[model samples]
Target chain A: MAAIILLGLNHNTAPVELRECIAFSEEDTELALEELHERTEFKEILLLSTCNRVELLLVTDDRETCVAEAKQFLAEHNRVPLDDVEPALYVHEGADAIRHVFRVASSLDSMMVGEPQILGQIKSAYRTATQKKTSGVILNRLLHRAFFVAKRVRSETGIGDHAVSISYAAIELGRKIFGTLEGKEVLLVGAGEMAELAVENLIRHHAGTIWVANRTFERGLELATRFGGRAIRLEEIPESLQHVDIIIGSTGATDLVITSDHVRAIMRRRKNRPLFFIDIAVPRDIDPAINRLTNCYVYDIDDLKEIIDENIEDRNREAIKGERIVEEATIRFSQWCDSLAVVPTIVALRRKMEDIIDEQIDKTLGGLKHFSETDREAFDRMKQALINKMLHDPTMFLKSNGCLGDRSLYLDVTRRMFNLDNER
Target chain B: MENLRYLIILLYLASTVSYLLYLFIQKDGFHRAGIYLLIAGVGIHSAEILYATVSSGQLPATNLYDALSIAAWAIALVFLVIQFRYKIRILGIFAAPLAAMVTILSTRLPETPIPAQNIFNSIWFIIHIVSVFIGDAALALACGVGLLYLLQEHAIKAKKRGFFYSRLPSLELLDTTGYACIVVGFTMLTIGLITGFVYAKAIWGRFWSWDPKEVWSGITWILYAVLLHERLTVGWRGRRAAIMAIVGFCVVLFTFFGVNFFMKGHHGQFTTF
Candidate 1:
């Protein structure tokens, strides 16, 4: 293969200490990328430097020479034996190298099953390398194609969607009953860690004004004011209940702070507008019985967790769909890599054949008295047409089936049929 | 055809047993067998349907009963495909019996020769059928996760690793997928309901007639729509969302088989009309 191969170590192969030993800071990564690209064998090179990995996707045809140089560079920097780290490295050549890049960019090989951060990370690495002019044709094509596949996986599957978190679900419930939470006021009751996290989530959703109410009032007041909402007394439950669209009660009251009658009375006061109630307390602060009322939605902590669970399940359900897409895109990327090999071969063959035919026809017709210029031109055109018609089937077949592992037969047949070996 | 149906039922039974065994043993063999069994069942189920179509000289889209049967099979087929693809063995813990139950119940539905007409002429029928199956499959998966969430929460409360606690995906992955299923299923169901409404307007001269099926379906749609909007816009998700998803599927179950059996609605005469 004319392509450059890469060899590198990552989290999968070695522990953190070993990885840190071979690692370079972000500044040095740009410098190393520049240095590698300047070498003759390096048509392109990019260093993917992350906490878990520091892989160099380098382009060079001389695999053994590149590995030897890279090993020397790392050993001199680390002051460690090159033999000890030899087992930690993996080499990928040609199509395998291209497939590896796609998988890395898509995050199918990630520790977290469907994490999305890797794509952005890869893009940044590609950008940094490009900025330093360390990337050439091969790496440029691979990185750009990797980004496209990553985008497709994101859109086609729910892998990146849904945080599947209890905190996120608490916020989702708040948005459900209330159409727009932009200007809506939320009354957050209690200061439990889980309850606080849910409130943090709701705040992220831009729940406009938040009021914190706790037994002590002071404990709740501190967290509330930070989010730009006021603190209310526990006794002001009824008054606060009417003003807020969401009542997230997480008090450890061991009884209901918001009862059915409290909700009924509030529903009457608010002109029967929908109220979202999430009682994220073990003792249950809001009465579950209140969910029986129309336009009044009540869900306990378990329900919120269940919502997150359901989201997780749904993502798992679509996991295969995502995998199939990633796999297909992987092969598609490899095919692109393979076709690039054929271009040069085809260019060389066409030139050599045309030269031989031109010289032979010219020499044969040179000393003929009856041979006119127009006749020779017509003969050349006929010869060229015959060459195209004869070579079309085998050339097309070889290029199309390049991935089938039987290309030698086509090359051999082409040389024998054309008898172009005699010139060399 | 009857023999093929028996084979399909046998596969269902085998899968149910394997899944139940999996709940206890958590063996890879049972998991693999469960997949094969389900695939075999679906393959036979598909062949049976194709055979029925040719032998009965009726198009698969002709009758309401056949449509429900086809819809049920579709649910099973989609779940099986995803199961085989994802190696999500825990889903079979619920999906198998649910598929078997739908298949069995579909048989109970009275079969009638489809009314002679170009019923499949309009594209609405295909849309309605497809959405029903997709929604049904989503609800099946949602119910499975919701059930697991309840069990896991129960186990967490009890501090015990019940059989379910071992097999289900992490509480996070489950809750996320459950919420997504509700969203996807709800979108499909909304399409189903809209198509039903359009089809209703074409046949009955109104978008809705306040039929029991119509009323209950509208209620189901609103409930799930609330669930989805809450998850996406407001950030309501987790075990609580899962419980709602399960509850929502109960309504879906009632919508699918119960309404035709117990409730009076326009859906009852949909085949004849």
Candidate 2:
């Protein structure tokens, strides 16, 4: 049976100096993959090189030799002795390797648990390895399975919800209310860097027709021009409120810029359309009372912070669930791998039985040379039926229980008992 | 023929289940399956109606069962067209079950034969019934969309961010679509009332009567007219307009079935108003 092996140094195992030394640049990764494929005996390989870690995954017939050779290659590439790198490397073989890959892809084993960037980083690594043609069928299936498992973990658990930052949380809430940012109108109430970051999020989500309002006209125009949006005076905000669907307020104003009465009046002019306000200013640009209105919703800085805290707590709890999913998927993948190992033994057993039946049939037909064509056909059918009935139980047993325990032992006993040729 | 009708009803029920799954699953593949099943159901229903019309030598909208079957068919037809055009697939979670419920109710009602009358012979009466049933179906759809708008609004205001909040269309989209359905329904209702007046004059020698069906339909029409008028002139939309749309549809329901079932009217003999 082929083995899966994972060899790597991560943030926990290696210091920063070792990680930097072990890491491969993007251009170097292509050359390294080519050289590794040409020099190493590992049948299939994938190299994942990220800032926090550099991992090498392999599928090979001899796991021990593959690991030794990979460690030597890493030390040689970094111009270090094998003994110098040995203490920093962690090795996982067989089922443990599969579980580790799944954990890595799902971000469970990241420096920061539930961090979203690690999944994307791993995906890029997989893509590069695929393009290099270093990863073949076994690695391809294994990596694709990891991607699916990661996706399942993301959707089933809220690990990626509630953006960790204030501006991102505002964008997340905006999406919850608006469904999609496409064709939505946004009004940025300040020209601060935080507000600019929120605008970046909005643009990333494809928000439509942004309007920038600030106390200073030139500042607002500068920010608006950078984002390809129009600029309006702060005094003109109420008039523009009727057209925009979302308001991101982060101005330096001391007093309230948007009051409950102002929102009420705007609601009437806007025909009671849904309006969302994100007040990130320290003194609160929009009144809290505005949220009580029918179609208007407001979230101040404290509320956003509270939401972010709650989201972090929710994600911590959800990570437990995600771990369980990865565990189940790893076991399923292992079982499928075990099943693959028994297929050849079952095929050989059936072929051996067929060969014996054919020999006996030849002898029987030779003795009945004077029989008519119909009598000869009847004799051949009887021989075939006997062979089928005889082999059915053994065939079922090898297929069903062959992969369960001591697979080599079962194959050995079957070979010796049946006197079958063990060609492979 | 009865078995075929039952089979069509079962298909509608299956389509309803598929649509609910589509909404919950939120998969494009599941949604396409739902739409195909609904289209197949509509096709079977049309065949059933065609078969009935050919064999009985009468219009398919002649009695209570036939009228209801046609109404259910019209509702699914209009919903499918709207879903295709607007791409609001979640609407089927409401529309499909409604069509299935109407079909199921039609099966339970006593499908008694109607006695022949001079009014039934007129082409004007047939046109009036068909137009009125189509209008009622459209209004029913408007009610469903109006409910969706309220639910979405409530989710936003209450901060109950969850499944329905994500699945439903934007408040603006639902509000405008509901308004459009009401407008089209109101137009058809006006034509229905006018033709009913003309048919009444031809059969009974009178254009106006204080019959409960006529009075209730008049009230329903006035209610929707005020809704449209407020929306267009006063710029009334969003929550207030959505509520009024629901209220208007309720009044329409009373005019369609409540008046006929409870009060004495010349129109009740036809089993629909």
**Best by the DockQ measure:** 2
- What would the per-residue lDDT of candidate 2 be over residues B1-273, giving only the tens digit for each residue? 678778878878888888877877777777887888889989998888778766665566656777788889989888987787677788888888888888888877777777544446687887787788778888988899989988987877776656687688777678778888888789989999999999989988999889999999999999989888887876678778878888988888777688888998876766642
* Candidate number of the best lDDT: 2
Could you give the DockQ of candidate 1?
Answer: 0.03
lDDT of each prediction vs. the true structure?
Answer: 0.72, 0.82
TM-scores of chain A across the candidates, in order, are 0.70, 0.69
User: Tens digits of per-residue lDDT for model 2 on A1-424?
Assistant: 6678999999999999889998988887877788888854677788889999999998887777888999999999888788878999999987899999999888888876678888888788888888888776567778999999999998888787667788888877776666677878889998677878888988888988899998989988988898898999988888888899989999889999988877778877776667999888988899889988877889888778877787778778888999999999999888656644556656666677677777887787788778888987787687668767877886677656454433444555676576654435
Candidate 2 colliding pairs, count: 0
For candidate 1, write residues A1-424 as lDDT tens digits.
5454667787799788888888878788877876776677665778887776667787766778887888776666567788867788888877677767776777766655467788888998988988998776567767888889878877777776665777766564444334346766788888777777777777777777898898997887888778788998998987778888777887778878988887777765675555778787888988888777655667787776776666677667666676777678767766545544555446556767788788888788876769787998898898889778866875687688663443433554455455534434
The alpha-carbon deviation from the true structure for residue A396 of candidate 1, after best TM-score superposition, in angstroms, is 24
lDDT of 2 at A101: 94
Per-candidate TM equals: 0.49, 0.76
Worst 10 residues of 2 chain B by lDDT: B112-121
Runs in model 1 with CA error above 4 Å?
A1-25, A35-43, A51-54, A65-91, A192-201, A249-261, A279-285, A342-344, A347-424, B1-273
